[model samples]
Target chain A: MMGDNEEILQQAADWRALGKGVALATVVSTWGSSPRPVGAKLALEQEGAFIGSVSGGCVEGAVIEEGLKAIADGKPRLLSFGVSNDRAWEVGLACGGKIQVFVERVE
Target chain B: MKLGFLQKALAASREGRPAVLATNLTNGLQTFIEATETAGDLTLDAAALQAIRKAVTEDRNATIETADGPVFIEVFNPRLRCVIVGAVHIAQPLARMAALTGYLVTVVDPRTAFASDARFPDVVLSTDWPDEAMEKLKPNRRTAVVTLTHDPKLDDPALSVALRSDAFYIGALGSKKTHAARCKRLQALGFNEEELARIHGPVGLDIGAISPAEIAIAIMAQITQVLRAEPQSDREAA
Candidate 1:
């Protein structure tokens, strides 16, 4: 665990060891002014529980709900945010930052 | 389910096992790397190091087959760390410098007076023998070992172990004349010329350092040079 996604992998391992269905979300790329770093992680549990962080604070709730669905369905997803002006404001994204988040099921 | 790869890499690193991180930065996929773990009590050889390095550089993350997968590795360097074996006047500044350079530094010595918390305020002070204390420090690809005690009893055994480990930098603080005599003794004890050559004696760069702080700066510079595997001349000027 020495790369950008090292912490994500570590968090995934910790969650899995707890007998939980965990989904790992990574901020693969980002543009403009964003609160979270590029490699920020978000872990969503099967019951809609969550740990770690992706964005600063914007869209976490929506992301968590989406993540819970992914875990319940046992499917992976790629989520995008803040590309357009209206899309950015809906999620409270500042400076119109665009980020691609990859959500993969880790069981 | 198959998380052993990540776990083992971190565990090996936490336990001071010498491991390298290989990152593959390319388009489409994310980071790509194929890091290898050195398993066993036996120290890894230079060939093994080269093999892992080759794996890191050759891991073209530009693209992968649909079945093969995307980027596989990212980042080659580990958490920067260093174990200073000897709590001397110079050790104090060296430990502090190492910490600032992102090294989790540990200063070891049998003398409590020298290895006191007051002297090494920023360092993890260990009053154990040099050899025993390094176990906690756990040298790795990201770790360096420096002998500043200038005591044979401490450095002799410590060097034996440090040289055999995967520490990327091994330096000893002593004058050239003192090291010449020390080298003779080490050779008598079975250390070959090649093994003895690894040590960077007179421990530091060409900087004309007279004070303890300056010496620390020079030594750290030497270490950075070693860690990056780049010639000192090629390093970007600060």
Candidate 2:
């Protein structure tokens, strides 16, 4: 079987080949005891189909929302989540760690 | 994040080529960096490229601050490999355990009766002589070589080849006295003390393992320690 990251990229490429909008989100950096390490990936298609993850489910919903926006706008975005941010609490990043995610459209 | 770059990254992963994907945060520009080639539009300076190469070699991913901006470098390295130079009973469990730990494993033995497919399911079996098999394997820094056969005719040639290669771990199974005699013979073959010292004879951590299965466990544990522990000096100090 292919590794998780390889599967994610392969899925994203397959989605793009099918003419579906695809976006890839990566855990670019982390601070404290982040659940996922840097280089973890989450690939999302326009209709909300997803593969892999950048967090331990706490921030994946928010990341998928941002990924959809990136797919729509053709603009890449860097998102940060931490206990210090109020949105982090709303998104349930209750692990007391911080993570930066880079979301980009797979053109 | 171009499709071409993604395809290239997939190819590198499948081909077991070490590579790095550097994505610039400022402009969303990206580049795929391999040892001999690169792709994408992002232009990296000498320092940044050097850092990327370092990360690839160390099998690490990091976000680096460069003059252009913050670039996230994601490294992809090939899987580790373990080559067992015997198809003995101990090799069965060791091969399974090593495979579970994510090492690509190969078992080598010239005896067709012992290295049969029924004995080793889902494993790459080599019915070639130890020296010929070791030559074909060409053990590298990511490889671990272990000689389970106590026969010097088989194990000696494999050990000699392993010592000459960059394999991160080299082990031989035998009693202490047997290992001493083996060392003496290898020394006669011109392997100096330093080179021969690299062989972990008596082959496992000094656990009082009696059964073949238990011995396999002990050997696996020692291999894990050598692979994951700090550098030799720090470990010796500890």
Candidate 3:
């Protein structure tokens, strides 16, 4: 099997070549007992297709929502999720950790 | 996050070269950093570039605080490789364990009887002579070379090539006396004292290992220790 990062990036490139909008989300930083390490990635297509991961299914839904926005606006976003934030609870990131994800459109 | 930079990073990974993608959070600008070149829209100052280069050499991903903002530097290093110069009993287990640990393992031996598919089910086997195989492999900083033939004709030539390469680890299977004799022979061929010291003769951590499989475990542990040791700059500063 191909490495996860390579596979995700390759898929993103393929999607872009097909005239589909794609956004890439990367975990830039983490604190406490984070589920995924820093530099983990999650790629999303405009049609709601996604690959790779930035968390243990705790914050991916929120990240994908932000990724979709990025794809639509062609603007990058930095999202912070932590137990201290009410949004984190809403997003179910109650794993006693915090993560910062950078979402950007694949230009 | 430009497509061009992503493709460049992918190409570098495919070629087994180290690379880094530095993203400026403030402006969404990015730069791709390779060993001898830099590309992309983001221009970095000397200090930032120096920090990125250090991160690349150390194989670390970091978010550095720059005046512009937090720039996340994602390092992409080549996968580790293990080149076994013999297909002995120890090699069988060693190869399997190395592959399990994510190493691209290759076993080199001219003796088809020893390097047969039955002996190494899923491992890459090279039937070339020891020296020739070493020449083709060209072991580098991400590679470990181990000679286990216990035959001077096969192991010695391979050791000669491995010693001259940039391989991170070099090991030879032998006892103290045998290693001493081997060192003498290598010295006669113009290897310096420091170069000879690079080889882990008697090849494994001293765990009192007795069986071939146990010895393989010890060697694998030793290799991991070497691989995860302090980065060069930290070791030098210490």
- Candidate 2: what is its chain A TM-score? 0.95
lDDT of 3 by residue, A1-107 (tens): 11357778889999999999999999888777777777788899999899989999999999999999999999999998888877855875767778899999999
Per-residue accuracy of model 1 over B1-238 as CA lDDT, tens digit each: 1245446555644554434432222222221223432332223335534554654443211111233233222223355678888889888888877876767788888989788888877578888887777765667666689998888999987887787788889999899999998899889989899999989998989899999999999999999888654422322221
Task: Give the TM-score ranking, best first.
Answer: 2, 3, 1
Q: At residue B112, give the lDDT of candidate 2.
A: 90
* Among all candidates shown, the one with the greatest TM-score: 2
In candidate 3 the C-alpha lDDT for residue A24 amounts to 96
Better model by DockQ: candidate 1 vs candidate 2: 2
Candidate 1 Cα lDDT to native: 0.66
The runs of at least 3 residues in candidate 2 whose Cα sits more than 4 Å from the true structure, single-residue gaps closed, are A1-23, A34-36, A42-74, A85-97, B205-217, B231-238
Expressed as tens digits, the lDDT of each residue in B149-174 for candidate 2 is 88999999999999999999999999
For model 2, how big is the iRMS in angstroms? 5.1
DockQ of 1: 0.12
Error of 1 at A81 (Å): 20
Taken in order, the candidates have interface RMSDs of 7.3, 5.1, 5.2
The residue-by-residue lDDT of candidate 1 on A1-107, one tens digit each, is 23334455666778778888877675655566665654467876777767767787787876887787767876656667885745565775664576666666664
